[model samples]
Target: MPQKQIYALPNIVSPANPVIFNPDICNGCNTCVEVCQIDVFIPNPEKGKPPVILHPDECWYGGCCVNHCPLPGAISFNWPVQQRAYWKDKATGKVLRDSQ
Candidate 1:
């Protein structure tokens, strides 16, 4: 019988939350916490305080929290570099990076 080797992916750590909250702009409504499907945000101890990101890695990047926010520019999400979309033109057959 031969032994099998198992390997883990290299150089990957738990990803940081792409979502950011502007404290000044946020009204502490907790809408983001309620909208997040992945349980990413948790309520702050103080009443009427903005929620905090409880599990950054659990976020699915669905944009629900950002869209539901009542205050404009309050919630911002920076998509991870690795998740950037690559678009290919069907007619030209050229590939373009989304961030470009």
Candidate 2:
């Protein structure tokens, strides 16, 4: 008989939160819930309540929620430290990149 080998994986903590919703600014409009491509936000159970982040790990950092939010400064995204820095050049339509 042959013996089977088991592998273990190391756990690493992420430094940034993919999406942050400010309850003070959030109007609970559900715009974020509708705009998220990954379905990260869900409507709160109570009416007129802020949506909840259901799947933070699944967020793609697409900024759809932030772009579509009706309230200013309601949503924000922070890239994980492990990922590279991303920026956009308005003059040439180029995406800028850098290390954290």
Pairing residues by index, what is the TM-score of model 2? 0.63
- Stretches off by above 4 angstroms in model 1 are 1-13, 85-100
TM-score of every candidate relative to the true structure: 0.66, 0.63
Query: What are the per-residue Cα lDDT tens digits for candidate 1 across 44-87?
Result: 87777678777887888989999989998888887778988899
Model 1, residue 36: distance off in Å is 1.1
Across 9-90, the per-residue lDDT of candidate 2 in tens digits comes to 5653344367677888987899989988989878998767778777777888889999988898887776776676689999
- Candidate 2 clash pair list: none
Q: Tell me how far the alpha carbon of residue 99 in candidate 1 is from the true structure, in angstroms, after superposition.
A: 6.7
lDDT of each: 0.82, 0.79
lDDT for residue 73 in candidate 2, whole number 0-100: 87
